[model samples]
Target: MNFQKNKDEVFQAVANATEEAHRPQNSVKIIAVTKYVDSSIAKDLLKTGIEHIGENRVDKFLEKYEALADLKLTWHLIGSLQRRKVKDIINYLDYFHALDSVKLAAEIQKRANKPIKCFLQVNVSKEESKHGFMVEDIHQAIETIKNYDKIELVGLMTMAPFGADADQLKDIFSKTHALQKELQQLGIANMPFTELSMGMSGDFKEAIANGSTFVRIGTAFFK
Candidate 1:
C-alpha cells in the first residue's frame, strides 16, 4: 500500500470535516490504530508523520511497543484493559482511552508510577456489547475518580455502534460531545475534560462534525 497517498486522503477528509464543523484547522488529531497490523507496518505508517499509535490488545501493544522502542511515538491503549494486566503496561502508555470504570482507574493508580492521561469511556450508544459507563453514571464515576492522583481525566472516549445510520451517528456523537461539555463545566481538578475521542474509520466525518478531538483510524490507513 502507498502510505503517503493513503495518509493524504485521510488527512484531507479530516480537514474537510473539521472545516465543515467550523472548528479550527489542526484542532483534531488522528490516531493510527495499529491493532491489526504488525509493528513493521506501524513503523512505515509513522514515517508518514503519524505520531500517535493505538492498539486494542495488551499483547499486541507490548509487542509493537518493544519493536518501536527506538522511535518517538505516543502510545494509546484503546481497548478495555484487564485489571490484572495493569501492572504490565500502565506505565508505558501516554494515553489510556478505555478508562471505563472506577475499578480500572484505581488499578492504574496502584500500578502506574506517574500520572496517566485518561479518557473516560462512555457508552453513549447504550449498546449492550460496548464497555463504558452509562451516561447517567458518569457523574458518580467522576466523584469517585477524583481521588486517583495517578490518573488525569483528559477527555471522554466512545464507540458508536457499528452500522449506525447518519442520524444515529449524529445523535450518539452529539450526546457524547454534550456530555463532555457538561463534565468540562464541572471544573474538577483532575478532569480537564478538554478532548473527545470519538470516530473510527467509518464514521469519523459525523464524529468530527460533532466535535471530536481525536479520531482513531485503522482500516482506512491500511487500505
Candidate 2:
C-alpha cells in the first residue's frame, strides 16, 4: 500500500535522524500525526508496522477510533485537552500528549476507564501561545497526579515557539530534558517520566540531541 511506502520512508528518516543526532542510547519513537488524515491511511501506515497515530481533536479521534477497533493502534490525544472534554477523550484513546494543567490531568484520571498514559506538556520556551504547564508548576502537577487513579503520568512533551531560530532550538529541547530529569527524580510512584516528546518536522534532529523519546511528525512523514 502507498501508506506502507510512506511509513517506510518516514521510519528510514527517523533512523537517519536518530543516527544523525548520534545519541544511540536514546531512541526516538515516531507518532505519525494523522490529524485530518483519514483512517485508510492510518490503517495503511499500521500495516507498514506503525503502532501510533496522533489525532489533534477529541471528537474526530473518537469517531475514527470506534471505526478502526480491529486494528491494533495507539491513539494519541495530541491537542490541548479542555477540562470539559476530558470525559470524551478518556473513552477510546490511551496515550496522550497535551495535558496542559494539573486540573486537566485530574479530570483525565477521573474520566479514564483504564490506566491511560500521559505526557505532561511543558512550555519550555515559556511562550504565551503554547499549551503546556509552566516549569514552576511541574511539581504541583505531579502532586495532583497522586490524587488520580485511572491514569499514569509517563513523561513530558512540548513544541517550541514557531519560527524558533536554529540557534535557540537546543535551549528549548534541553530545558525539556532537564525538566524530565527533575520530574523523574521526584519518584512519582508508577508514573515514570521517561519520554521527552519534543520536535516537529523541522528541528527533530535537535530535539533528539536533547533527549526526545517521541517525535510527532506530520508534514515530514505525510509530505
For all candidates, the clash counts are 0, 0
Best candidate according to TM-score: 1
Error of 1 at 167 (Å): 0.2
Give each prediction's root-mean-square deviation over alpha carbons: 0.8, 1.9
lDDT of 2 by residue, 41-68 (tens): 6666666777787889887788778777
Query: What TM-score does candidate 1 get on C-alpha atoms?
Result: 0.98
Candidate 1 runs further than 4 Å off: none
lDDT of 2 at 77: 81
Candidate 1 structure quality by residue, lDDT tens digits, 10-67: 9999999999999999999999999888999889987888889999999999999999
Model 2, CA-based lDDT: 0.80
Candidate 1's displacement at residue 17, Å, is 0.8
